[model samples]
Target: MNQIDFITEIQKHEPKMFGLAISILKNRDLAKDGLQESAIKLWNQRDYFQKVKNKQAYCMQIIKNWCYDELKRKVNNHLRLQDDEEVEEGIGNEKDHVNDTYRRIKSLIEKLPSKQRLIIQLKDFEGLDFEEISNALKMEQGSVRVNLSRARKRLKEMYLEQENKIKMIQNEE
Candidate 1:
């Protein structure tokens, strides 16, 4: 692909790439950095774009790899430190139940295993099909479907469990 075409294609899929990064990194600032790095890397390797059969998948893979590397680096730097205290402090006023529920759901999703989370994010959030997700993650299409299903099922169970807990607490009141 030429310079213009490469830029245009990256722009077209930038949102999806950002979403993938955020899903993996679980931080907007870091996701932006990952996306920027991925874009630069992709631009530098523009010569190989012509040989790529699936540009979107290739771009997603680049973003995913960048995020994974960032996560690993973070783990190495803060092996004993935990960020949960900071995250809890950032929780807004209790009056906003909607925001609380949203945060809870997001947190639950983040707790899922890496592969399941990636499959869920790519397939459901980014609207990528099984084949696309498989290509991006380098897994079989069947494995992608299975992982997505398992992720969704696990999220549903978590939601229901939380709902029951809330009901039990309200009952005591």
Candidate 2:
């Protein structure tokens, strides 16, 4: 496609690209940096777009790689740190049961294995199909399906375990 067409197509999926970056990085600033870098890379490599079967999947793959690289750099540099203030802000409105539930689920998701977490995020949160996920992650389609299934099963089990624990605590009370 031409520059205008490419820019237009990319604009359509920019939000999703940024969302995926944010989900992986867990820091808005880092996610924005990743997105910007990915966008620039995409623009520079626009020629490859003609050969790509799925543009969105290709773009996502770029963003995912950038986030993974950033994560690795952080790990190597020992730069990873949780922002307690951010977590505290999120929990401020404890009266909102829905928000509490959301936070619990989010925490559970963060506990999942990295591969399972990415699969769950891509398939469930980003609403990508098996083909897209496989392409983006460079995995076989069957592997992608299996990973997603296992992730969902694990998440369900964790949720049930937490529910049971809550019930037990309530009963004790």
Candidate 2, residue 9: the lDDT equals 80
TM-score of 1: 0.82
lDDT of each: 0.81, 0.82
Per-residue lDDT tens digits of candidate 1, residues 1-173?
Answer: 67789889999889988888866776777788888899899988988965788888899899989888888888888853232322334455764676666668777887799889878977887788887778778899998888999999999998899889999999999
Residue 137 local lDDT, model 2:
80
1-173: candidate 2 lDDT, tens digit per residue = 68898789889778778767867887778888888898889888888876787788888889989989999998999997442225324445655687767678778888899788888987887787888778778899999888888989999999999999999999999
TM agreement with the true structure for every prediction: 0.82, 0.84
Model 2 segments more than 4 A misplaced = 1-3, 81-95
Superposed Cα RMSD, model 1: 3.7
Whole-model lDDT for model 2 versus the true structure? 0.82
